[model samples]
Target chain A: MALNIKPLSDRVVIEPAAAETKTASGIYIPETAKEKPQKGTVVAVGKGNKDHDMTVKVGDEVLYGKYAGTELKLEGKDYLIMREDDILAIV
Target chain B: MALNIKPLSDRVVIEPAAAETKTASGIYIPETAKEKPQKGTVVAVGKGNKDHDMTVKVGDEVLYGKYAGTELKLEGKDYLIMREDDILAIV
Candidate 1:
Protein backbone atom coordinates (compact mmCIF):
# COMPACT_ATOMS: atom_id res chain seq x y z
CA MET A 1 0.00 0.00 0.00
CA ALA A 2 1.17 3.52 -0.81
CA LEU A 3 1.90 6.04 1.91
CA ASN A 4 -1.17 8.20 2.43
CA ILE A 5 0.78 11.37 3.16
CA LYS A 6 1.29 14.03 0.54
CA PRO A 7 3.84 16.74 1.25
CA LEU A 8 3.37 20.32 0.13
CA SER A 9 5.38 22.33 -2.38
CA ASP A 10 9.11 21.61 -2.36
CA ARG A 11 8.69 19.38 0.68
CA VAL A 12 9.18 15.66 1.02
CA VAL A 13 8.29 12.93 3.46
CA ILE A 14 11.12 10.65 4.49
CA GLU A 15 11.17 7.48 6.50
CA PRO A 16 14.18 7.83 8.73
CA ALA A 17 16.70 5.06 9.11
CA ALA A 18 16.24 3.08 12.28
CA ALA A 19 18.39 4.23 15.16
CA GLU A 20 21.40 2.10 16.03
CA THR A 21 20.71 -0.35 18.82
CA LYS A 22 24.33 -1.43 19.35
CA THR A 23 27.88 -0.11 19.34
CA ALA A 24 30.55 -0.81 16.73
CA SER A 25 32.28 -2.88 19.37
CA GLY A 26 29.16 -5.09 19.65
CA ILE A 27 27.92 -3.60 22.88
CA TYR A 28 24.17 -3.57 23.27
CA ILE A 29 22.57 -0.16 23.74
CA PRO A 30 19.10 0.51 25.02
CA GLU A 31 16.53 2.30 22.82
CA THR A 32 16.86 5.38 24.99
CA ALA A 33 20.59 5.46 24.31
CA LYS A 34 20.28 5.92 20.53
CA GLU A 35 20.70 9.10 18.51
CA LYS A 36 18.24 10.21 15.84
CA PRO A 37 19.22 9.02 12.37
CA GLN A 38 20.38 11.46 9.69
CA LYS A 39 19.63 9.25 6.75
CA GLY A 40 16.30 8.26 5.24
CA THR A 41 14.34 6.95 2.26
CA VAL A 42 12.20 9.47 0.43
CA VAL A 43 8.64 8.27 0.26
CA ALA A 44 6.82 11.32 -1.05
CA VAL A 45 7.87 14.42 -3.00
CA GLY A 46 6.15 17.70 -3.73
CA LYS A 47 5.87 19.41 -7.08
CA GLY A 48 8.41 22.14 -6.72
CA ASN A 49 7.69 25.79 -7.28
CA LYS A 50 9.01 27.89 -10.19
CA ASP A 51 12.44 28.53 -8.71
CA HIS A 52 13.23 25.03 -7.49
CA ASP A 53 12.92 21.56 -8.91
CA MET A 54 12.15 18.27 -7.23
CA THR A 55 15.22 16.09 -7.75
CA VAL A 56 14.64 13.03 -5.63
CA LYS A 57 12.01 10.41 -6.33
CA VAL A 58 10.38 7.83 -4.13
CA GLY A 59 12.72 5.12 -2.73
CA ASP A 60 15.83 7.29 -3.02
CA GLU A 61 18.08 7.12 0.03
CA VAL A 62 19.13 10.59 1.10
CA LEU A 63 21.32 12.29 3.69
CA TYR A 64 20.08 15.43 5.44
CA GLY A 65 21.20 17.93 8.05
CA LYS A 66 21.20 16.77 11.67
CA TYR A 67 18.60 19.32 12.71
CA ALA A 68 16.63 19.49 9.48
CA GLY A 69 12.91 18.67 9.01
CA THR A 70 9.86 18.35 11.25
CA GLU A 71 8.81 15.14 12.94
CA LEU A 72 5.68 13.39 11.72
CA LYS A 73 3.77 10.23 12.62
CA LEU A 74 1.38 8.12 10.59
CA GLU A 75 0.02 4.69 11.23
CA GLY A 76 2.42 4.33 14.15
CA LYS A 77 5.45 4.95 11.92
CA ASP A 78 7.74 7.96 12.27
CA TYR A 79 8.58 10.26 9.36
CA LEU A 80 10.19 13.58 8.67
CA ILE A 81 8.94 16.44 6.52
CA MET A 82 11.38 18.96 5.06
CA ARG A 83 12.21 20.99 2.00
CA GLU A 84 14.39 19.49 -0.70
CA ASP A 85 17.05 22.05 0.08
CA ASP A 86 17.45 20.55 3.54
CA ILE A 87 18.66 17.31 2.07
CA LEU A 88 22.43 17.39 1.79
CA ALA A 89 22.89 14.59 -0.72
CA ILE A 90 21.51 11.43 -2.22
CA VAL A 91 23.43 8.43 -0.94
CA MET B 1 28.85 54.91 -6.86
CA ALA B 2 26.95 51.74 -7.61
CA LEU B 3 27.82 48.57 -5.72
CA ASN B 4 29.85 46.28 -7.98
CA ILE B 5 28.70 43.03 -6.45
CA LYS B 6 26.39 40.80 -8.45
CA PRO B 7 24.91 37.78 -6.67
CA LEU B 8 24.18 34.61 -8.62
CA SER B 9 20.90 32.79 -9.09
CA ASP B 10 18.37 33.25 -6.30
CA ARG B 11 20.99 35.12 -4.26
CA VAL B 12 20.94 38.71 -3.05
CA VAL B 13 23.34 41.32 -1.71
CA ILE B 14 22.30 43.19 1.41
CA GLU B 15 23.77 46.04 3.42
CA PRO B 16 23.20 45.28 7.08
CA ALA B 17 21.82 47.96 9.36
CA ALA B 18 24.28 49.60 11.69
CA ALA B 19 24.62 47.83 15.02
CA GLU B 20 23.11 49.60 18.00
CA THR B 21 25.60 51.87 19.70
CA LYS B 22 23.49 52.76 22.72
CA THR B 23 21.47 50.77 25.24
CA ALA B 24 17.84 51.53 26.07
CA SER B 25 19.05 53.25 29.23
CA GLY B 26 21.36 55.49 27.14
CA ILE B 27 24.48 53.55 28.03
CA TYR B 28 27.11 53.72 25.29
CA ILE B 29 28.07 50.29 23.95
CA PRO B 30 31.46 49.68 22.43
CA GLU B 31 31.66 48.61 18.80
CA THR B 32 33.21 45.37 19.94
CA ALA B 33 30.21 44.64 22.19
CA LYS B 34 27.37 44.82 19.64
CA GLU B 35 25.44 41.94 18.13
CA LYS B 36 25.07 41.58 14.38
CA PRO B 37 21.93 43.28 13.12
CA GLN B 38 19.16 41.26 11.49
CA LYS B 39 17.76 44.05 9.35
CA GLY B 40 19.24 45.18 6.04
CA THR B 41 18.68 47.02 2.79
CA VAL B 42 18.61 44.96 -0.35
CA VAL B 43 21.28 46.21 -2.69
CA ALA B 44 21.21 43.57 -5.35
CA VAL B 45 18.76 40.82 -6.24
CA GLY B 46 19.23 37.80 -8.44
CA LYS B 47 17.06 36.73 -11.35
CA GLY B 48 15.57 33.68 -9.69
CA ASN B 49 15.72 30.23 -11.17
CA LYS B 50 12.89 28.45 -12.96
CA ASP B 51 11.41 27.18 -9.73
CA HIS B 52 11.37 30.51 -7.90
CA ASP B 53 10.63 34.12 -8.73
CA MET B 54 12.37 37.17 -7.37
CA THR B 55 10.00 38.90 -4.98
CA VAL B 56 12.23 41.66 -3.63
CA LYS B 57 13.81 44.47 -5.59
CA VAL B 58 16.81 46.61 -4.90
CA GLY B 59 16.24 49.19 -2.17
CA ASP B 60 13.76 47.09 -0.22
CA GLU B 61 14.33 46.80 3.52
CA VAL B 62 14.22 43.24 4.72
CA LEU B 63 14.47 41.07 7.79
CA TYR B 64 16.51 37.91 7.63
CA GLY B 65 17.52 35.04 9.83
CA LYS B 66 19.98 35.88 12.59
CA TYR B 67 22.78 33.86 11.01
CA ALA B 68 21.74 33.89 7.37
CA GLY B 69 24.06 34.79 4.47
CA THR B 70 27.81 35.01 3.87
CA GLU B 71 29.83 38.11 4.69
CA LEU B 72 31.36 40.17 1.91
CA LYS B 73 33.45 43.32 1.60
CA LEU B 74 33.39 45.77 -1.25
CA GLU B 75 34.88 49.28 -1.39
CA GLY B 76 35.55 48.93 2.33
CA LYS B 77 31.80 48.44 3.03
CA ASP B 78 30.30 45.32 4.56
CA TYR B 79 27.58 43.37 2.79
CA LEU B 80 25.89 39.98 3.01
CA ILE B 81 25.16 37.53 0.22
CA MET B 82 22.24 35.18 0.73
CA ARG B 83 19.36 33.52 -1.05
CA GLU B 84 15.98 35.25 -1.17
CA ASP B 85 14.56 32.43 0.92
CA ASP B 86 16.70 33.66 3.79
CA ILE B 87 14.73 36.86 3.95
CA LEU B 88 11.89 36.52 6.44
CA ALA B 89 9.98 39.63 5.32
CA ILE B 90 10.16 43.01 3.69
CA VAL B 91 9.51 46.02 5.83
Candidate 2:
Protein backbone atom coordinates (compact mmCIF):
# COMPACT_ATOMS: atom_id res chain seq x y z
CA MET A 1 0.00 0.00 0.00
CA ALA A 2 1.20 3.53 -0.82
CA LEU A 3 1.05 6.58 1.41
CA ASN A 4 -2.02 8.71 1.26
CA ILE A 5 -0.81 12.30 0.87
CA LYS A 6 -2.46 15.40 -0.44
CA PRO A 7 0.11 18.06 -1.08
CA LEU A 8 -0.90 21.54 -0.01
CA SER A 9 -0.83 23.78 -3.01
CA ASP A 10 2.08 23.08 -5.33
CA ARG A 11 3.98 20.91 -2.95
CA VAL A 12 4.94 17.33 -3.77
CA VAL A 13 6.02 14.50 -1.49
CA ILE A 14 8.59 12.16 -2.95
CA GLU A 15 9.94 8.93 -1.50
CA PRO A 16 13.66 9.17 -1.97
CA ALA A 17 15.55 6.11 -3.07
CA ALA A 18 17.53 4.43 -0.37
CA ALA A 19 21.09 5.47 -1.07
CA GLU A 20 23.32 2.77 -2.48
CA THR A 21 26.26 1.66 -0.37
CA LYS A 22 28.25 -0.23 -3.00
CA THR A 23 30.30 0.86 -5.99
CA ALA A 24 30.58 -0.58 -9.51
CA SER A 25 33.75 -2.30 -8.33
CA GLY A 26 31.66 -4.17 -5.70
CA ILE A 27 33.24 -2.17 -2.95
CA TYR A 28 31.06 -1.86 0.12
CA ILE A 29 31.14 1.87 0.76
CA PRO A 30 30.27 3.25 4.17
CA GLU A 31 27.59 5.74 5.08
CA THR A 32 30.12 8.57 5.08
CA ALA A 33 31.12 8.12 1.47
CA LYS A 34 28.05 8.07 -0.72
CA GLU A 35 26.88 11.00 -2.81
CA LYS A 36 23.18 11.76 -2.60
CA PRO A 37 21.03 10.22 -5.27
CA GLN A 38 19.20 12.53 -7.64
CA LYS A 39 16.40 10.09 -8.26
CA GLY A 40 13.25 9.36 -6.28
CA THR A 41 9.80 7.85 -6.49
CA VAL A 42 6.76 10.07 -6.14
CA VAL A 43 4.93 9.07 -3.02
CA ALA A 44 2.39 11.85 -2.53
CA VAL A 45 1.63 15.03 -4.41
CA GLY A 46 -0.12 18.24 -3.46
CA LYS A 47 -2.53 20.42 -5.36
CA GLY A 48 -0.93 23.19 -7.34
CA ASN A 49 -0.07 26.20 -5.25
CA LYS A 50 -1.56 29.58 -5.92
CA ASP A 51 1.53 30.77 -7.70
CA HIS A 52 3.43 28.79 -10.35
CA ASP A 53 0.86 26.30 -11.38
CA MET A 54 1.65 22.77 -10.31
CA THR A 55 3.01 20.60 -13.06
CA VAL A 56 3.68 17.28 -11.33
CA LYS A 57 1.25 14.68 -10.05
CA VAL A 58 1.29 11.70 -7.74
CA GLY A 59 3.17 8.55 -8.78
CA ASP A 60 5.36 10.48 -11.16
CA GLU A 61 9.01 9.55 -10.81
CA VAL A 62 11.30 12.55 -10.86
CA LEU A 63 14.97 13.43 -10.93
CA TYR A 64 16.30 16.09 -8.62
CA GLY A 65 19.63 17.27 -7.30
CA LYS A 66 21.58 15.24 -4.79
CA TYR A 67 20.96 17.97 -2.29
CA ALA A 68 17.34 18.54 -3.15
CA GLY A 69 14.07 18.33 -1.14
CA THR A 70 13.41 18.95 2.54
CA GLU A 71 14.28 15.96 4.72
CA LEU A 72 11.38 14.53 6.67
CA LYS A 73 11.15 11.42 8.79
CA LEU A 74 7.81 9.68 8.74
CA GLU A 75 6.97 6.36 10.35
CA GLY A 76 10.67 5.87 11.02
CA LYS A 77 11.44 6.32 7.35
CA ASP A 78 12.92 9.50 5.84
CA TYR A 79 11.11 11.14 2.94
CA LEU A 80 11.16 14.50 1.20
CA ILE A 81 10.25 16.60 -1.86
CA MET A 82 8.46 19.91 -1.70
CA ARG A 83 6.98 22.25 -4.24
CA GLU A 84 7.06 21.60 -7.94
CA ASP A 85 9.54 24.42 -8.24
CA ASP A 86 12.02 22.47 -6.16
CA ILE A 87 11.79 19.63 -8.65
CA LEU A 88 14.29 20.16 -11.45
CA ALA A 89 13.25 17.46 -13.88
CA ILE A 90 10.70 14.65 -14.15
CA VAL A 91 11.87 11.24 -15.22
CA MET B 1 37.40 35.72 -2.96
CA ALA B 2 33.96 34.14 -3.51
CA LEU B 3 31.95 33.42 -6.60
CA ASN B 4 29.62 36.18 -7.78
CA ILE B 5 26.03 34.98 -7.72
CA LYS B 6 22.66 36.65 -7.83
CA PRO B 7 19.73 34.36 -7.18
CA LEU B 8 16.77 34.88 -9.45
CA SER B 9 13.72 35.98 -7.52
CA ASP B 10 13.27 34.00 -4.31
CA ARG B 11 16.02 31.53 -5.15
CA VAL B 12 19.01 31.44 -2.82
CA VAL B 13 22.37 30.02 -3.83
CA ILE B 14 24.00 27.99 -1.12
CA GLU B 15 27.44 26.42 -1.13
CA PRO B 16 26.82 23.00 0.33
CA ALA B 17 29.23 21.61 2.86
CA ALA B 18 31.41 18.88 1.50
CA ALA B 19 30.00 15.57 2.69
CA GLU B 20 32.12 14.10 5.46
CA THR B 21 33.84 10.88 4.51
CA LYS B 22 34.84 9.62 7.95
CA THR B 23 32.84 8.57 10.97
CA ALA B 24 33.56 9.22 14.64
CA SER B 25 35.23 5.84 14.81
CA GLY B 26 37.67 6.92 12.11
CA ILE B 27 36.21 4.55 9.58
CA TYR B 28 36.79 5.72 6.03
CA ILE B 29 33.53 5.73 4.08
CA PRO B 30 33.36 5.53 0.35
CA GLU B 31 31.33 7.69 -2.07
CA THR B 32 28.47 5.21 -1.76
CA ALA B 33 27.69 5.38 1.92
CA LYS B 34 27.37 8.91 3.28
CA GLU B 35 24.12 10.63 4.11
CA LYS B 36 23.78 14.06 2.55
CA PRO B 37 24.48 16.98 4.85
CA GLN B 38 21.78 19.58 5.27
CA LYS B 39 24.16 22.40 6.13
CA GLY B 40 25.52 24.86 3.61
CA THR B 41 27.06 28.31 3.24
CA VAL B 42 25.24 30.97 1.31
CA VAL B 43 27.41 31.75 -1.67
CA ALA B 44 24.93 34.02 -3.50
CA VAL B 45 21.38 35.13 -2.73
CA GLY B 46 18.74 35.79 -5.28
CA LYS B 47 16.51 38.85 -5.40
CA GLY B 48 13.53 36.67 -4.52
CA ASN B 49 11.01 35.49 -7.02
CA LYS B 50 8.01 37.55 -8.07
CA ASP B 51 5.36 35.46 -6.34
CA HIS B 52 7.20 34.84 -3.11
CA ASP B 53 8.65 37.97 -1.55
CA MET B 54 12.37 37.71 -1.01
CA THR B 55 13.38 36.98 2.55
CA VAL B 56 17.04 35.81 2.58
CA LYS B 57 20.06 37.85 1.58
CA VAL B 58 23.59 37.14 0.47
CA GLY B 59 26.15 35.50 2.76
CA ASP B 60 23.50 33.88 4.83
CA GLU B 61 24.33 30.42 6.13
CA VAL B 62 21.32 28.18 5.89
CA LEU B 63 20.30 24.63 6.64
CA TYR B 64 18.30 22.49 4.28
CA GLY B 65 17.27 18.87 3.89
CA LYS B 66 19.58 16.17 2.65
CA TYR B 67 17.63 15.89 -0.55
CA ALA B 68 17.13 19.59 -0.99
CA GLY B 69 18.13 21.86 -3.89
CA THR B 70 18.94 21.46 -7.56
CA GLU B 71 22.44 20.19 -8.28
CA LEU B 72 24.85 22.31 -10.21
CA LYS B 73 28.48 21.49 -11.01
CA LEU B 74 30.29 24.77 -11.13
CA GLU B 75 34.02 24.82 -11.82
CA GLY B 76 34.25 21.10 -11.06
CA LYS B 77 32.61 21.49 -7.64
CA ASP B 78 29.04 20.42 -6.92
CA TYR B 79 26.79 22.93 -5.12
CA LEU B 80 23.09 23.36 -4.53
CA ILE B 81 20.28 25.12 -2.56
CA MET B 82 17.47 27.12 -4.05
CA ARG B 83 14.54 29.36 -3.06
CA GLU B 84 13.95 30.59 0.43
CA ASP B 85 11.09 28.15 0.59
CA ASP B 86 13.47 25.31 -0.12
CA ILE B 87 15.54 26.28 2.88
CA LEU B 88 14.09 24.67 5.99
CA ALA B 89 16.11 26.71 8.46
CA ILE B 90 18.83 29.32 8.33
CA VAL B 91 21.76 28.79 10.62
Candidate 3:
Protein backbone atom coordinates (compact mmCIF):
# COMPACT_ATOMS: atom_id res chain seq x y z
CA MET A 1 0.00 0.00 0.00
CA ALA A 2 3.03 2.29 -0.16
CA LEU A 3 3.38 3.40 -3.72
CA ASN A 4 4.76 6.83 -4.53
CA ILE A 5 2.63 7.38 -7.58
CA LYS A 6 0.28 10.31 -7.29
CA PRO A 7 -2.66 10.66 -9.60
CA LEU A 8 -3.06 13.98 -11.36
CA SER A 9 -6.06 15.84 -12.64
CA ASP A 10 -8.94 13.49 -11.99
CA ARG A 11 -6.95 10.31 -12.49
CA VAL A 12 -7.01 7.49 -9.97
CA VAL A 13 -5.11 4.33 -9.18
CA ILE A 14 -7.05 1.31 -8.01
CA GLU A 15 -6.49 -2.21 -6.86
CA PRO A 16 -9.00 -4.34 -8.68
CA ALA A 17 -11.18 -6.87 -6.96
CA ALA A 18 -9.76 -10.34 -7.08
CA ALA A 19 -10.91 -12.44 -9.98
CA GLU A 20 -13.46 -15.07 -9.07
CA THR A 21 -11.92 -18.47 -8.89
CA LYS A 22 -15.01 -20.57 -8.36
CA THR A 23 -18.63 -20.62 -9.38
CA ALA A 24 -21.55 -20.45 -6.98
CA SER A 25 -21.85 -24.21 -7.20
CA GLY A 26 -18.21 -24.64 -6.14
CA ILE A 27 -17.11 -25.53 -9.63
CA TYR A 28 -13.81 -24.09 -10.63
CA ILE A 29 -14.12 -21.63 -13.46
CA PRO A 30 -11.45 -21.54 -16.10
CA GLU A 31 -9.56 -18.30 -16.55
CA THR A 32 -10.65 -17.79 -20.14
CA ALA A 33 -14.33 -17.92 -19.28
CA LYS A 34 -14.19 -15.94 -16.08
CA GLU A 35 -15.79 -12.56 -16.27
CA LYS A 36 -13.39 -9.75 -15.46
CA PRO A 37 -14.36 -8.15 -12.17
CA GLN A 38 -15.45 -4.54 -12.44
CA LYS A 39 -15.08 -3.62 -8.80
CA GLY A 40 -11.99 -2.27 -7.05
CA THR A 41 -10.63 -0.33 -4.12
CA VAL A 42 -9.32 3.14 -4.72
CA VAL A 43 -5.69 3.41 -3.75
CA ALA A 44 -4.87 6.95 -4.77
CA VAL A 45 -6.90 9.91 -5.90
CA GLY A 46 -6.33 13.11 -7.87
CA LYS A 47 -7.33 16.70 -7.54
CA GLY A 48 -10.55 17.69 -9.22
CA ASN A 49 -10.38 19.38 -12.58
CA LYS A 50 -11.54 22.90 -13.28
CA ASP A 51 -15.19 22.03 -13.65
CA HIS A 52 -15.70 18.92 -11.57
CA ASP A 53 -14.79 17.91 -8.05
CA MET A 54 -13.90 14.33 -7.15
CA THR A 55 -16.47 12.36 -5.16
CA VAL A 56 -14.30 9.43 -4.13
CA LYS A 57 -11.39 8.95 -1.78
CA VAL A 58 -8.87 6.34 -0.82
CA GLY A 59 -10.29 3.00 0.38
CA ASP A 60 -13.66 3.47 -1.29
CA GLU A 61 -14.87 0.35 -3.10
CA VAL A 62 -15.93 1.39 -6.57
CA LEU A 63 -17.61 -0.16 -9.54
CA TYR A 64 -16.18 0.71 -12.90
CA GLY A 65 -17.21 -0.09 -16.41
CA LYS A 66 -15.93 -3.32 -17.80
CA TYR A 67 -12.87 -2.68 -19.97
CA ALA A 68 -12.20 0.68 -18.38
CA GLY A 69 -8.72 2.04 -17.53
CA THR A 70 -5.24 1.22 -18.67
CA GLU A 71 -3.62 -1.67 -16.82
CA LEU A 72 -0.40 -1.03 -14.99
CA LYS A 73 2.07 -2.96 -12.87
CA LEU A 74 3.80 -1.50 -9.88
CA GLU A 75 6.34 -3.54 -7.92
CA GLY A 76 4.85 -6.74 -9.35
CA LYS A 77 1.38 -5.73 -8.22
CA ASP A 78 -1.36 -4.99 -10.68
CA TYR A 79 -3.04 -1.63 -10.79
CA LEU A 80 -5.37 0.37 -13.00
CA ILE A 81 -4.98 4.04 -13.83
CA MET A 82 -8.08 5.76 -15.04
CA ARG A 83 -9.85 9.07 -15.11
CA GLU A 84 -12.30 9.61 -12.27
CA ASP A 85 -15.08 9.59 -14.82
CA ASP A 86 -14.42 5.94 -15.53
CA ILE A 87 -15.54 5.01 -12.05
CA LEU A 88 -19.27 4.33 -12.14
CA ALA A 89 -20.40 4.04 -8.54
CA ILE A 90 -18.95 4.12 -5.06
CA VAL A 91 -20.06 1.09 -3.10
CA MET B 1 -26.10 9.23 -36.93
CA ALA B 2 -29.51 7.61 -36.98
CA LEU B 3 -29.10 4.76 -34.59
CA ASN B 4 -31.95 3.74 -32.35
CA ILE B 5 -29.99 2.22 -29.53
CA LYS B 6 -30.42 4.21 -26.34
CA PRO B 7 -27.99 3.99 -23.44
CA LEU B 8 -29.37 3.28 -19.99
CA SER B 9 -28.30 4.05 -16.42
CA ASP B 10 -25.41 6.45 -17.05
CA ARG B 11 -24.08 4.49 -19.97
CA VAL B 12 -23.18 6.46 -23.05
CA VAL B 13 -22.42 5.91 -26.70
CA ILE B 14 -19.65 7.89 -28.29
CA GLU B 15 -18.28 8.44 -31.75
CA PRO B 16 -14.54 8.43 -31.28
CA ALA B 17 -12.33 11.09 -32.71
CA ALA B 18 -10.70 10.06 -35.92
CA ALA B 19 -7.37 8.35 -35.57
CA GLU B 20 -4.41 10.32 -36.73
CA THR B 21 -3.32 9.18 -40.14
CA LYS B 22 -0.37 11.54 -40.36
CA THR B 23 1.97 12.93 -37.79
CA ALA B 24 2.26 16.65 -37.21
CA SER B 25 5.46 16.51 -39.22
CA GLY B 26 3.47 15.34 -42.25
CA ILE B 27 4.82 11.83 -42.18
CA TYR B 28 2.19 9.16 -42.67
CA ILE B 29 1.82 6.94 -39.64
CA PRO B 30 1.25 3.29 -40.19
CA GLU B 31 -1.91 1.73 -38.86
CA THR B 32 -0.13 -0.46 -36.36
CA ALA B 33 1.75 2.39 -34.72
CA LYS B 34 -1.06 4.88 -34.53
CA GLU B 35 -2.28 5.92 -31.08
CA LYS B 36 -5.96 5.53 -30.45
CA PRO B 37 -7.78 8.82 -30.14
CA GLN B 38 -9.08 9.65 -26.70
CA LYS B 39 -11.62 12.25 -27.68
CA GLY B 40 -15.16 11.68 -28.91
CA THR B 41 -18.60 13.10 -29.36
CA VAL B 42 -21.38 11.86 -27.18
CA VAL B 43 -24.15 10.37 -29.25
CA ALA B 44 -26.37 9.13 -26.48
CA VAL B 45 -26.58 9.35 -22.70
CA GLY B 46 -28.36 7.56 -19.89
CA LYS B 47 -30.31 8.69 -16.88
CA GLY B 48 -28.31 9.25 -13.69
CA ASN B 49 -28.31 6.57 -11.04
CA LYS B 50 -29.25 7.04 -7.37
CA ASP B 51 -25.99 8.67 -6.32
CA HIS B 52 -25.10 10.55 -9.46
CA ASP B 53 -26.80 12.76 -11.96
CA MET B 54 -25.82 12.82 -15.60
CA THR B 55 -23.61 15.85 -16.28
CA VAL B 56 -23.17 15.28 -19.99
CA LYS B 57 -25.68 15.81 -22.74
CA VAL B 58 -26.02 14.64 -26.30
CA GLY B 59 -23.54 16.21 -28.72
CA ASP B 60 -21.01 17.01 -26.03
CA GLU B 61 -17.46 16.41 -27.11
CA VAL B 62 -15.45 14.65 -24.44
CA LEU B 63 -11.99 13.50 -23.59
CA TYR B 64 -11.57 9.95 -22.34
CA GLY B 65 -8.93 7.55 -21.18
CA LYS B 66 -6.91 5.84 -23.87
CA TYR B 67 -8.45 2.41 -23.33
CA ALA B 68 -11.90 3.35 -22.08
CA GLY B 69 -15.17 1.89 -23.38
CA THR B 70 -16.25 -1.21 -25.23
CA GLU B 71 -16.13 -1.16 -28.96
CA LEU B 72 -19.29 -2.10 -30.78
CA LYS B 73 -20.54 -2.21 -34.33
CA LEU B 74 -23.99 -0.91 -34.90
CA GLU B 75 -25.39 -0.93 -38.42
CA GLY B 76 -21.90 -1.13 -39.86
CA LYS B 77 -20.80 1.88 -37.84
CA ASP B 78 -18.36 1.91 -34.96
CA TYR B 79 -19.36 3.10 -31.51
CA LEU B 80 -18.13 2.94 -27.95
CA ILE B 81 -20.32 2.21 -24.93
CA MET B 82 -19.08 3.27 -21.53
CA ARG B 83 -20.21 4.53 -18.17
CA GLU B 84 -20.49 8.27 -17.79
CA ASP B 85 -17.43 8.17 -15.62
CA ASP B 86 -15.37 6.96 -18.54
CA ILE B 87 -15.51 10.45 -19.92
CA LEU B 88 -12.75 12.61 -18.48
CA ALA B 89 -13.59 16.16 -19.50
CA ILE B 90 -15.98 18.07 -21.68
CA VAL B 91 -14.33 20.14 -24.38
- lDDT tens string, model 1, B9-62? 999999987775332223222233248876678999889887667777898766
- Output the lDDT of residue A37, model 2: 60
How badly does each model clash, as a count of residue pairs?
A: 6, 26, 3
Residue B88 CA displacement from its true place in model 1, Å: 0.3
Give me the displacement of residue B85 in model 3, in angstroms. Answer: 0.6
Tell me the deviation in Å of residue A41 in model 3.
28
TM-score, chain B, predicted structure 1 = 0.82
Query: DockQ for each candidate?
Result: 0.04, 0.04, 0.03
Report the TM-score of chain B alone for all candidates.
0.82, 0.70, 0.79
What digit string (tens of lDDT, one per residue) describes model 2 on residues B1-91?
4643334346666777566634334534244425666667777665444477776666666667667666654444566746678887655
- Give lDDT: candidate 2, residue B33: 29
Instruction: Give all TM-scores, in the order shown.
Output: 0.45, 0.42, 0.46
Per-residue lDDT of model 1, residues A25-50, tens digit only: 45342355358777778988867666
For all predictions, the C-alpha RMSD in Å is: 12.0, 12.4, 11.9
Cα lDDT tens digits for candidate 2, A1-91: 5775566776778887556533222322223325566546678877664565655566765545556678887777878857766665443
Task: Report every candidate's CA lDDT.
Answer: 0.72, 0.60, 0.71
Model 3 per-residue lDDT tens digits across residues A1-91: 5455556457888988777644334543235434667777898886765666999999888778778887654445677778889998876
Candidate 3 error regions (>4 Å): A1-91, B21-33
- Candidate 1 Cα misplacement greater than 4 A, ranges: A1-91, B21-34
